[model samples]
Target: MTLAQRTPAEEAPAGASYPDLRWFPPGTHITVRGLKKAFDGNPVYVGFDIDLPKGKIVSVFGPNGCGKSTFINMVAGLLPIDAGQILFEGKTIAETRIGYVFQNYREALFPWLRAIDNIHYPLRLMGIGKAERERRIEELVAGFDLKFDLHRYPYQMSGGQQQTVSIMRSLVIEPEVLFLDEPFSALDYEMTLIMRDQLQKVLVARGVTTVLVSHDLEEAVYLADKVLMLTRRPSRIADYMDVDLPRPRDPSTLTDPRFIDLKARTLEVFQNAVRAS
Candidate 1:
């Protein structure tokens, strides 16, 4: 269905309405209300409410051990929500095409497949032909700056290299929504910044709706358009702060007062969650 078919929330901005949600494509207009989850009777989250708009980058933040990863997994359909509904583009989770990049590079990439083959795996599953798959893979490898060791196995590549391949594999099929669970945590400080900048460009260019979970406060504020701060587990959103600064943002923009204000606000919410926990 087109964006025009969607019924807009009463508070949506002017010239922006449902059935015409072009501003937030790929991403779901998620209304997460009363969400709760438990494993073996241990509750991780409860009574959460969040509105994740389309095409926007949302950073899910909380103190360590908060249900940030669990929340992301539930949204990605890797884990089932014990209670509450996850709506994607006004549809159920089953209707969305999600790409998940796990926290660990070792787990996300395959040791058995070559880089190109791994990148092509999803496209092949989607029934894309050989020529198209090669074209897509070439584009991804170049865009992400994959090494010439394309035919080498994951074990042969460095940590950063494996991560680049893993990320490329996830993006090959152009998922409707992308979940990045600390995709840069494994990289060294310098590599992290480089990858962060590159990933931001790629996500914006592809118009992919992205939800990122990261412990790096600066990274969250830098990469996300909105920050969703969660209370410690059983996790719940304490505050949602929008980063009103301009887009195609440079890392240098992090030094600006507006960006600093947003970061400070986000940290305050995090501190509140910690104390409340």
Candidate 2:
């Protein structure tokens, strides 16, 4: 399962510019086929295949060590695929602009830089002009209605604030394929609720095709337009479910009979996966 470790080098070169972003358009659906990966000769994923729909939130649910992050990292071009293709808009991952939010918000954002600078960092790397960079930041903040003081440093802000910056950083580019690896796992109860609502609003409005990995059943069902249930190691999609719930999912969505039923079904499959593994 070992391939060349330098696959990331094949992506858009460091000095290259970010491509034009299409606003209000649902980006391409990602198509994966015969995907394979291994770390230190240990297979984590094998023949993993799924089609992530356009402008939809697909929450990936699985037990611990199921290679959720690994799958996403490979798609984000942060890690190389040993075998198979991950296609989006007729191009490979290396050819596309990707947005990834790591689970560890504490380590994701640079401590020395201000929150505004952190959001601006990705745009900076892409050689975005100051004017254009400011425009992107303004659009993202205003669109999300985020009120965090970006002038403060990451260490100076609350955990929720720091994670918000991480999310903003990942999203500044408005990538077609956005990978959120346990994006809210570090937040408090109140912050989680806020982030979930905020994420739904922005993503739904802009129509980014998001893939989220989460352990929280309620959160998964709450935010997802669909859910991809994965098995244990050497993971594969056990079931693909359409949410069938109404939009603008609020606190009331939790009490809806359909939501409760779907949540229970997802949990049962997850528990079965844990034991079968």
lDDT against the true structure, per candidate, is 0.81, 0.84
User: For residues 28-100, could you state the per-residue lDDT of candidate 2 as single tens digits?
Assistant: 4787767999889988888877778888999988888888778778878888899887888657877888898
Candidate 2 off by > 4 Å: 1-28
Candidate 1 TM-score, C-alpha based:
0.86
Give the Cα error of residue 245 in candidate 2, in Å: 1.0
Worst 10 residues of 2 by lDDT: 1-10
TM-score of each: 0.86, 0.87
Which candidate number maximizes lDDT? 2
- What TM-score does model 2 achieve against the real structure? 0.87
